[model samples]
Each structure stands twice: as structure tokens, then as C-alpha cells.
Target chain A: MLVYLIRRIGQSIMVVAVMATLVFLAVFAVGDPVAILASPDADQRELEAITTRLGLDRPIYEQFGIFVWNALQGDLGRSFVYAQPAVDVILQRFPATMELALAALILSILLGVPLGVIAGLKPESLLGRSIMTTSIFGFSLPNFWLGLMLILLFAVQLRWLPASGRGETVEVFGVHLSLFTWDGLRHLFLPALTLSLYKASLVIRIAQAGTREVMLQDYVRFARAKGLSYNRIVFVHVLKNMMIPVVTVLGLELGSMIAFAVVTETVFAYPGMGKLLIDSINRLDRPVIVAYLMLTVVIFVIINLVVDLLYAAIDPRVRLTESKG
Target chain B: MSKAVLDVKDLSVSFRTREGLVTAVNSISFSVGAGEVLGLVGESGSGKSVTGLAVLGLIDPPGEIDPRSSIKINERELIGLPEEKLRRVRGKDVAMIFQDPMTTLNPVLRIDTQMIEAIRAHEKISEKAARERARQALEKVGIPSADERLKAYPGQFSGGMRQRVAIATALLNRPTVLVADEPTTALDVTIQAQILSEVQQLCSETGTALVWITHDLSVVAGLADRVAVMYAGRIVEEGPVSAVLEAPIHPYAAGLIGSVPSRNKRGVPLAQIRGMTPSLTNLPPGCPFAPRCDYATDICRSTMPEPTPYEGGRAARCHHPLSAPTPAAA
Candidate 1:
């Protein structure tokens, strides 16, 4: 297991390095930060001064070398707008995105698994048909559109929830968190719901398909023949076996969830890393953009590693490799 | 033989398929007494396994058990019983072990969990008591290191060991009837004999009515007290294992026993039953086995033969029952 972990960590380092190089080249290849940061009325000499001050005058390779050197030494440069370390600026906003992703994942599992199992258990039933139909809609609808629709329905007309922004954060062990307070959850709901609908649909499809297939396995029939109650057979036997595929797919989905919370965050104007990323892009905040991209890459790597470990844990056949078949 | 512990009468299992109503198990009547093993012998598609499933009330739709059929355990009717009551009857009164032990036991769950569930599903006993019974059951099946083995998963066990675990679980509740459908078919030859003996010993000791379903006549020859031979969906012949093996009245049964490698002359070609089982969706007018029977005549094609009893307390479903004289009881 330790060897496996070490190998995974080594792979993650390679992934991070590749991502850093791509993010650096891609950011530099796009619109020049000088044009966006400098005033249009500025004289040529003044523009030159600004360019040199931001180190734009340096050669591309030289600039990349300097960036790499500082990045390796635990400095991701400083954000132009926040006037803080780019890593720190992004980290400050990380919590909001983390909370949103966690909430979305929880909602997806809680709602998707049971509903999916129901659909799988009785595909011909009216309720099962309706659940599957609704899941299709959830899967097809765009995250931004769903976010806007949720806002219009709940916030605009009903006036039940705050339309935008994180509400009333309370300190929890020296970390700011809005999820604990009722007002905060009210704020978190629309955005989290928007983020989760597609994911929930994915879960539903996986669980439903998985449950349907697992239901036909001989063990399931054996379990039934053992006089296990309907609930026990479905929940214990079917659910455990079905969860294998679900976990693999969902683990991969989670990385994309945290990375792509961008669209939902933008639609709801939720203050998170995605919203911060959008603002940094608009202002041509090169350092913040680079740092955010790099962090995202590292996070994806970590998630993949954790998923492999989790797979081994859930499936005994995987963990006990030396055992006879 | 002891008094009947399980009696199945006119049990017919059908599947509604695109082709039409396909009868997998035609009206079949048989009984097993406590401490007795009845080997149900047949070909791949011959309804023997279906009969085993019907005995456990497990014919899931698209498959259905005909309402006209009856399955009784201790004289308690099982056909048309509510799912709730049927479930209670299963695993408790009648447990089943399947063909592929690799698939019979849930791979992810530990051995103890599966065994304990089998016990607790019927009896409302504490987990501790169930665990103890599970442990003892494992030991009964001759699995060494009972405590450690219980903690291990199915994949950890070999194919033969896995089948033993399945047998142990089936016997956990000391069910009155145990339906084992080709449970040893997937095993090695030596493993097959060992498990065959272990199961036979356990059933006789517990007085559990055992229905051993298999296409292997040699297996039945050694293990079963009585044997029923099915062709297509009907029991073509049934009698004491020795009598049927020595002199089968039904031509199909005769062909089956004759095809056994050991029974055939060493230099001659092996005898065989020609023609595949007729599709249940479109059976021939007369006996389902007529197309394959060498003795099939106009009467055999025009009408089916009802099961007829002969000397030696044996029966065969054949208009032209073989004239092989009954041998003296061994």
C-alpha cells in the first residue's frame, strides 16, 4: 500500500509539472496583460515603463524560468488585484468552493441512490418512470441555466432565499464557514442544487444501471432464497455490489465537480474560487490565474490517488491480492 | 425412506417470452423424505433445475409457477403463497445452493455475514447467536480455521471451498428441504466427490430433504437414494437409483444410462440420445422426447404417454416402456 501511495504521489508530481507548463504558456499566449492593465491614454514611454514594471519586457523563456524558480520555492508570485500571494488569494476562496462541492456530492448521493434504486427495483412502475423522466431533464439541463432558473423561482418571486453572495459566515475552529448557519444554507442551497443536478443525474443513471445488473446476479437470487427481506436484499446486498461502479465513476466526477463549479458559481454570483477566477481573468490577473490553474491540477491528482485507495478499501477482492480465487 | 418432508405435485413453471408461453417445467410430481436424497437428472435445458427453483418458490416473472401446481413442506402448501410467507419458507424450510459457487456467494461480503444473514433472515436471533451458529456450520462443512475463514471474503476461498461455504450457509438454518442445482458441476473431480459426500452426510444427519439436480448420471448413481430422469420438461422415469441404473424402462432414461462412459462397451462407440430438447414454445404433439426416441411410432407421435408404474415400485412415461427385466435388489 505504501509503495502504491508513493507511486501515485510521483505520478501526481508529473501531472502538476505538466499542468504548470501548459497554464504558463497558455496564459502568456493569450491577450497581453499590459493592454488590459494600462490606460489607453498613456504615452508610449509610460506604457514601456508599465510593461517593464510587470516584467513583460523579459523574454518568454526567461519569464518562464523565473516563474518556475519562484513556484518551486513555495511562492506563486502575488495577485495584482488582491496584493497578496496568489496561492493565499486562491486559498481564501477555496473554502466556499469546497463547501459547495461537498454539499452537491452529499445531495447527489442522498437523493440519487435511493431514487435510482427505486427506479431499478421497479422500472415498470409509474413512480419509477417519472423518476427516470425527471432525471433525464436534470442530466440535459445546463448548470448555468438551472442556477438562473432556481434563482428566479426561489429568490426573485418567492423571496425565500438571498439571491446571491455567501450569507453570515461563523468561525469554526478559526476557519470561516457559511454552511453552519441557517441563512448560510439558504444561501448555499440554490447554488449547490444547481451544481448537483447534473451530477445527481449521473449518479442516478449509474446506480439504476448498476442495481438492475446486480439484481440479476446469482448472489442476489441466493440472498432472496435465503429469505432476506426486500429491504435487506436491496439495501445490503444490491446496494453494496452496485456501489462499486458508482464509486469509481463518482470519484472521477468529484474532481471535475470542484474544477467546474465555475459555471454555477458565476450564475448565482456565489463568492468562491470560480468567481475569483472569473474576476482575475477579466482584470488580466496573470499570477492569480496561473496559481488557480496549478492548484486545480494538484487537486485533481490528489483526488485520483484517493479514489484508487478507496476502490481497494471497498472491494475486498482488490485488497487481498495474494488470496486464492 | 422416512416420511415425506417435501411433496411437489404437478409443478409447472412457464416463461412468457417473445416466442410465446414457454413451459420450462411441465407438470412434474415428486417427493423427498427426511434424510433422503433425490437426484433429479436431465440434459441442459431439461426442466430439472426449474423444478429445483420451483421447489424453493423462486420462479421470478417473466417466469411464473402455474397456479394449478402445488409444493408442500410438512403438508403446508407453497404454490400461490404470498411473497412474504414464501420468503419465510425459503432459506428456513427450504434453502438452495446454486451451480456456480463463484457466483452463489456475494463476493464483497465476508463469509460470516452471508452465513449469519441466512440464519437471522428466518429466525429472529441475536447476531451473536447467529454468528456462533455460522461458525459451527462452517466447521460442519469441514472448513478449517473457522473463525478466520468467516472473516475472509468469497474471492479469498478456492472454487471448491466457496461451494463448501455455500453448503454451510444452506445448512445453517437446518432447512427441511435443500435444493442444490448442479452445485458440484463447476468443481474439480476430487473436490466434487468430497463436497458430494459432505453434503450427503450433512443432509442425512439433519434429516433435511435433499433434491440434488444434475445432468451427470454417474453423480446420481453414487449419491442419490432415488433418481428422477427428466426429458424436456417432464419426468420420463423415476425409481430406486440402483433399479433405474440397472434397467431403465423409459427409452430416454435407458439412453441416458447407456451413454455413461463406464456402462458402454470399451471398443464400441458410445450410445447417445439423438435430437435436442424440443423447444417448449412449440413441443411435438405427442411425447416431448418422441422426436429423439428410436421407438417413436404413430401412437407415440399422436398422443403423450402418462406416467405408468411397473414392477419394483418404479415408473416410466413411455407407451413402449423398455422390456429390460428388473434386476434383484442389491
Candidate 2:
């Protein structure tokens, strides 16, 4: 187990390194950040001084080497747009995005899995067919469009909830949480609900397919023959067996939720990392762009690692097979 | 008979499929007594497995057990029984062992966890007690190092070994009836014989009534106290193992026994039944086997044959019963 963890961590490090190199190259390939930073009225010498100060005058490889060195020390350079450390700027916005993503994920799972299980158990029933049919809308409708529609319905027409922003927040253990308070949750509900609709449907399909397949397995029949209650059989035996596919999808989906939250964030005017990313992109803030790219890569790698580890814990087939190697 | 462990009468199973309602097991009836082994022999679609599943009340919806049918394990009626009572009766009063031991055991669970859960499912026992019983059950099935084997997952065990574990799990609760649906069909020949003998011995020793469902006549000849031959969802012939094997009255049973390779003269081609097993869907009106029988007559084609008694607790479902022949003389 220790060896497997070490091997996984080693692979993750390699993936992060490759991603970092690519992001660095792409950031440099685009027009230099010096153009956006220097004033048009400045003379050539003043522009040269600014370029030298930002180390843009150095050779690309030398600049990259220094970037790597400073990155190792947790410095992803300073954002010219914010005039602050890029990592710090990203960190400041990360909590809101994390809160939203986590809520969306929770909503998706809580709603989708049970609905999927029901649909799978009775795939031919009227309710099952309707659930499945309704899930298609989740797939067909874009999150941005869905977000707008939800805002128009609940916020515009009904006025049941607020339309935009992160609203009020309380600090606990130096972390901003938008959960529990009425104002915070009211602000959060529409965005989270809109984001979850598509993924929840995806989860429903995955869970349905998985449940259907696993139900046919001989072990499930054995469990039934063993006289286990339906609840026990479904929850303990079938649920665990089905989780392998669901968890894999969930891991990939979560990483995607964080990275691709741009549209939803923009739609709601939610001040999140995705919003920060958009502003940085328009300004050609190279440090922020590269940092965001690297951060996303790190998150993807970590999530994948966690999912693989969870496989071993949830399914002994994976764990036993790994131990043999 | 010592005591009837399981009593099933007029049990018919039908499935509501997209094409139509297909009968899988039709008006089948059989019983097992304590320490008695009943071999349910048939071809692939002979409803032998369905019979076993139906006996355990494990048949799900879209595949319905006929409401008129009765399945009583230890005088506790299974038909129309609520799920709660049915569950208690299942692993405690009767248990089922399935084909493909590789699939019968959950791939993700440890042997001990599965076994203990099986034991605890019926009885309220401590995990320690359940584990001890599981260990003993494994050892009973000839698995070595029972304690260590308990910790191993199902995938770690080979095919034969896994089957043994499955058998052990079935026997963990020491239920009165064990309905094994071709449990060793997927095993190596040598391993098949070993498992057959071990299961036979275990059932006798524990007084657990056994319904060993299989397609192999040789296995039934070796293992079962009585043999019931099924064809197209019905029991065509049933009797003591020697009586049925030696003098099968039904033509289908006779055709089955004749096809056994060992019975034919050396260098001669093996005897085979003339036609394929008919499809269960859209079965012809009268006797299902009449089209395939050599001696099928007008009466055979127009009317289903009821089971007629012959001798020595034997019965065969046939319009024109075949002449009884002794195995040694043949």
C-alpha cells in the first residue's frame, strides 16, 4: 500500500511538472505581459527599465528556470493586473469557488444517486421512464442558459432568492463559509442548483447504468438468496459495487466543475477564481494565467490520485490486485 | 423418508418478456427429505436453475412464480409470503448455491466478511461467533488454513477453491435445504468430481436436504440419492437413481441416458436425441416432447401426458411409456 501510494505520488509529480512546463511555454508564446504593463508615453529607456525589473529581458529558458525555482518556493510571480502575488490573488478567490463547487457536488450526489437507483431498479416503470426522460433536459440545456432561466424564474419572477453575488459570509478558522446563513445560502442556491442540474443528470445516468449492471451480477442474486433485506442488499452490496464507476466519474466531474465554472461564475457575477481568470485573461496577466493553469493541473492530479486511492479502499479487487504488484 | 426438508408442488415460473409471456418452469413438483439428495438433471434451458431459484423465492418481477404454486420449507409456506418472513426462511431454512462460483461470491468482499454476513443475516450472533462458524464452514469444504483464507478476497482463490468457498457459505447457516444450481459446471473435471463428492458427503453428514441441479447425468448418477429428469420446463421422469438411470420410462429420459458416452459400444458413434430442445415460447399445444419422440403417436401429439406411476416409487410423464431395461443386461 505504501509503495502504491509512493508510485502514485511520483506519477502525479511528473504530470504536474509537464503541465507546468506547458503552461509556462504557452504564457510566454502569447504577447508579452510587458506590453500591457508599460505606459504608451514612456520612453524606450523607461520601457527597458520596466522590462528589466520584471525580468522579461532575460532569455526565455533563464526566465523559466527562475520561474521554476520561485514556484518551488511557492511564488508564482506577481500579477501585473492586480499588482499582487498571483498565487495569493487566486487563493483569495478560491474559497468562494470551492464553496460553490462543493455545494453543487453535494446537491448533485444527494439528488442524483437515489433517483438513479430508483430508475435502475425499475427501469421499465412509469416513474423510472419519467425520471430518465427528465434527465435529458439536464444534458441538453447549457449551464449558462440554465443559470439564466433559473434566475429569471426564482429571482426575477418569484423573487424567492437573490439573483447574483456571494452575498454575506462568516469567517471560521480563517476560512470564509457561505453555508447555513439565510442570506449566504439564498445567494448560493440558484448558482449551485444551475451548475448541479447538468452534472446531476450525468450522475443519474452513471448510477442508473451502474446499478442495472451490478444488479445482474451473481453476487447480488446470492445476497438475495442469503435472505438479506432489500435495503441491505441494495445499500451494502449493490451500492459498493456500483460506486467504482460513479466515483471515477465523480472525481473527473469535480475537477471539471472547478476548472469550467467560468461561465456560471460569469453568469451570476460570482466573485470566484473563474471570474478572476476571465479578468486576467482579458488583461493578458501572464502570471495569473499561468498560475491558474498550474493550479487546475495540480487539482486534477490530486483528485485523480484520491480517486485511485478510494478505489483500493472501496473495492478489494483493486486493492488485492495492486498488492500483487 | 426421514423428513421432508423442502416440499414444492405445482410450481410454474413464467416471464413477461417483450416478445410474450414465456414459461420457464411449468407445473413442476418435487420434494427433498433430510439427508436426501435429489439430482435435477436437464439440458441448458431445462428450467433446473429456475426451479432452484423459485425454491428459494428469489424470482424477481417480470418473471413471476405462479400464485397457485406452493413451496413449503419445514411446513412454512413460501408462496405469497411477505419479504420479511421470506428472508428469514431463506438462509436459515433453505439456501441456494449458484453456478459460476467466481461470480457467486462478491469480488470486493473478504471471505470471512461474506461468510460472517451470511451467518449473521439469519441469526443474531456476535461477529466473533460468526467468524468462528465461517472458519469451520471453510474447513468443512476442505479449504486449508481456514483462518488465513478468511482474510483473502474471492479473486485470490482459484475456480475450484472459490466454488468450495461458495459451498461453505451456503452451508454456513446449516440450513435444512441446499439448492445448488450446477455449482461445479464451470470447474475442471477432476475438481468437479472432488466438489461433487465433498458436497454429497457434507449434505449427508449434516442431514441437509440437497437439490443438486445439473446437466451432467454422470454427476447425478454418482451424487444423487434420487434423480429427476426435466425437459422443457417439466419433470419428464423421476425415481430412485438406480431405477431412473437403469430403466427410464419416458422416451426423453431414455434418450438422455442413451446419449451417455460410456454406455455406447467402443468405436461406435454416440447416440443423440433426434431433435433440439423446443423453445419455451410458443410451445405446441399438447406434449412438448411429442415432436421429438420416436414413438410419438396421434394421442401423444394431442394431449399432455400426466405423470404415471410405474414401480419402486418411480414415475414418468409419457403417453406411451418405454419398456424398462436393466442397466447390466443392456
Candidate 3:
């Protein structure tokens, strides 16, 4: 297990390096951030000063080397727009996005797993078919549109909840959280709901598939024959087996959830890393943009590594095979 | 004589398919007394395994047990029993050991968890007590170092050992009836013989009725006190093992015995039953085996024959049974 962890960490490092290099080159290849940062009427000399100040005048290779070195030192360069270190700016907004993602993930598991199991257990039943039909909307409807529809119905028409923004905040353990405040929870609901719908659908499909497949396995039949109560058979036998694949999907989805939150955050005007990313992109904040992309990539790689470890934990067969390697 | 532990009467199992209603098992009746081993012998698709599942009330939707059918364990009706009551009876009253031991035990769970869970399902025993029983059960099945083996997962065990664990689980609660659905089919001959004897001895000691479902006549010849030969979805012949193996009355049963390699001359091609199994969805009005029976007559094709007593408590579902001068006791 120690060797496996060490090997996975090594692979993760290589993956992160490749991603950083690619993003560095891609950001540079795009239209210059200098134009967006500089005044339209700035003279050549003024522009040159700004360009050199930002290290734009340096060769691409040298710029990339400096970027890699700074990244290794835990410094993503200063944001052109915010005039602050990109890492600090992202960190300040990370909590909001994390909160939203976590809530959405919790909601997805709470609603999707049970519903998926029902659908799988009785695939031809009326309730199962209806759950499946509704989930298709979750998969197909765009998050932005879903967000808008929710805002229109709940905020504009019904006025049951706030339309946009993270509401009032409370300090707990030296951290300001919106989840505790009533107004903040009300504000958090719409965006989180819209965000979770799509993910919940994905969970439903995965869970249903996993449950159905495991239900046919010999062990399940044996469990039933052993006279296990329906509850025990479903919960202990079927659920444990089904969770292996579901956990893999959820781990991978978490990274994408952060990535996809950009549109959702923008739609609801939620103060999160995704919204910050959008603003940074518009203002030509190259450091912030590069940092965001690299962070997401690293997160994805780490999540996959964790997922591999979880597979071994969940299944002895996998553990045996992994040990042999 | 010991009381009958399982009494299945006119039991039929059918599945609702997109094409039509497919009868997997037609009206079949048999009983296994306590300490008795009844071998349900049939080829693939012969509904032998379905009968075992139906007895356990394990058939799910798309597959339905006929309402009129009756399956009683220790005189308690199993068919149409409520799920809650059936659950109480399951594992406690009757348990099943399935085919493919490699897959029958949950791959993720330790042997102790699976075995103890089976015990605890029927008995409200302490975990420690359950574990003790599980260890004893494993030891009874010839597993060495039973205490250590209990901690290992099913994937860590070999095929034969896994089957032993499965057997241990079934016997954990000392169920009144134990249905083994070809548990050794995936094992080697030596392992198969070992398991067969061990299971037979265990059942006799515990007085648990044992139904060994298999397609191998030779397996039945050795392990079973009585044998019932199934063709398609019906039992074509049933008698004491010695009688059935020595002289089968039904043509299909005779053909099955003949198809066994040991029955033929060493140099000759083995005898075989002619024709494929009739499709359950579109079976003829008469006997399902009539189309394949060499002695099939017009009467055989016109009407299905009910099981009839021949001699020595033997029965066969046929118009004309093979004549044997000697009569044997059950």
C-alpha cells in the first residue's frame, strides 16, 4: 500500500507538470493580456513599460521556466486585474465554490442513490419509469437555463427565496460561512439545486446501472436465498457492491463539478471561484486563469488517485491484483 | 421413517417474456424427507435450478411462480407466503447453495461475515456465538485452520475451498432443507467427490433434507438416496438411485442413462438423446419428451401422461415404460 501510494503520487506529479506546461503555453498563445490591461490611448513607450513590467517582453520559453519555478515555490503570479497574487485571490473564493459543490454532492447522493436503487430494483414499475424520465431532464437541461427557470419560478413569481448572491454570513471557527445564516441558505438553494440537478442525474444513471448489474450477481441471489431480510439484502449486500462504481463516478465528477460551476456561478451571481474565473478571463487576468486551470487539473489527478485507492479498499479482488503489481 | 422436510406439489414456474409466457417448470411434484438426499438430475435448460429457486421464493418478476402450486417446508406453505414470514423461514427453515462457488460468495466480504450473517439472520445470537458456530461449520466442511480462514475474503480462496465455505454457510443454521444447485459442477472430480461425501454425511448427521440439483447422472448415482430425472420442464422418472441407474423406465430417462459414457462400450461412440430440448414457449399439447423419444407413439403425441406408479415405489411419466423383471425396494 505504501508503494502504491508513492507510485500514484509520482504519476500525479508528472501529470500536473504536463498540465502546467500545456496551460502555460496555451495562455501565452491566446491574444495578449497587455491590450486589455493597458489604456486604449497609451503610447508605444507606455505600452512597452507595462509589457516588460508584466514579463510579457521575455521569450516564451523563459516565461514558461519562470512560471514553473514560481509554481514549484507555491506562487502563481500576480493577477493583472486584481493586482494581488492569483493564488490568494483564488483561495479567498475557494470556500464558496467548495460549499456549493459539497452541498450539491450531498443532495445528489441523498436523492439520486435511493431513487436509482428503486428504479433498478423495479425497472419496469411506474415509479421507476417516472424517476428515470425525470432524470433525463436533469441530464439534458442546461444548468444556466435550469438556474434561470428556478429563479423565475421561485424568486420572481413566488418570492420564496432570494434570486442571487451569497446572503448574510456568520463567523464560525474563524471562517465566514453562509450555510448557517437563514438568508444565506435561502440564497444558496437555487444555484445549488440547479448545479445538483445535472450531477444528480448522472448519479442516478450510474447508481441504477451498478445496482442492476450487481443484483444479477450470484452473491445477491445467495443473499436472498440465505433468508436475509429485504432491508439487509438491499442495504448490506447490494448497496456495498453497488457503491464501488458509484464512488468512482462521484470522485471524478467532483473535479468536473468545480469546473462546471463557472456557468452555474455566473447564472446565479454566486461569489465563488467559478465567478472569479469568469471575471478574470474578461479582464485578461492571465495568472488567475492559468492558476485556475492548473488547480482544476491537479485536483482531477488527485481525485483519480484517491479513486484508485478506494477501489482497493472496497474490493479484495482489486487489492490482491494491485498488490501483485 | 423420518418426516418429509420438503413437499412440493404440482409446482410450476413461468416467465413473462416479450414473446410469450414461457413455462420453465411445469407441474412437478416431489418430496424430500429429513436425512434424505434427492438428486434432481437434468441437462441445461431443464428447469432443475428453477425448481430450487422457486422453492426458496427467490424468483423475481418477469419470472412468476404459479399461484396454484404448493411448496411446503416442514408442512408450512412456502408458496404465496408473505415476504416477512418467508424471510423468517429462509436460512432458518431452508437454505440453498448455488452453482459457481467462485461467484456465489460475496467477493468483498470475509467468510466469517457471510457465515455469521447467515446464522444471525435466523438466530438472534451474539456476534461471538455466531462466529463460533461459523468456525465449527467451516471445520465440519474440512476447511483447515477454520478460524484463520474465516477472516479471508472469498476471492482469496480456491474454487473448491470457496464451495466449502458456501456449504458451511448453508449449514450454519442447520436448516430443515438445504438445496444445492450443482455446487460442485465447476470443481474437479476429486474435489467434487470430496464435497459430495462431506455434504451427504453432514446432512445425515443433522437430519437436514438435501436436494442436490445437477445434470450429472453419475453424481446422482453416488450421492443421492433417490433420483428424479427431469426432461424439459417435467420429471420424467423418479425412483431409488440404484433402480433408476440400473433400469430407467421412461425412454428419456433411459436415454439419459445411456448417454453416460460409462454405460457405452469403450470403443463405440456414446449414445445420445435425439433432438434439442423443446422450446418452453411453444411446447406441444402432449408430452414434452415425445418428440425426442424413440418409442414415441401417437398416444404419446396426443396426450400428456401423468406420473404413474410402476413397481418398487418407482414412477415414470410415460405410456409405455421399459420392462424390468426385478423389483427393488425404495
Per-candidate chain B TM: 0.96, 0.96, 0.96
Model 3 per-residue lDDT at B54: 92
C-alpha displacement of A22 in model 2, angstroms? Answer: 2.3
Who wins the DockQ comparison? 1
* Candidate 1 per-residue C-alpha lDDT over A230-292 given as tens digits, one digit per residue, 9 for 90 to 100: 999988899998999888888888888887788888988888999899999999999999999
For model 3, report DockQ.
Answer: 0.80
Q: Estimate, for each residue in B163-268, the C-alpha lDDT of model 3 and write its tens digit.
A: 9998889888889999999999999999999999999999999999999999998899888999999988999999899988888898888898889897348889
Residue A114 in candidate 1, Cα distance off native in Å: 0.7
Model 3 chain A is weakest, by summed lDDT over 10 consecutive residues, at A169-178
Off by over 4 Å in 2: A39-49, A57-62, A180-182, B324-330
Model 3: lDDT of residue A82: 84
Clashing pairs in 1: none
Residue pairs in candidate 3 whose N, alpha carbon or C atoms collide under 3 angstroms? none
TM-score of each candidate? 0.96, 0.93, 0.96
Predicted complex 1: DockQ: 0.84
**Per-residue alpha-carbon lDDT of candidate 2 for residues A1-325, written as tens digits (9 for 90 to 100):** 8889999999999999999999999889888667777887888899899889888899999999999999999899999878899999999999899888988999999989999999999999999999999999988998899999999999999999999999999998898888867899999999999889988999999999999999999999998888888898898888888878989998999998898799999999999999999999888898999999999999999999999999888888787778888
Chain A TM per prediction: 0.95, 0.96, 0.97
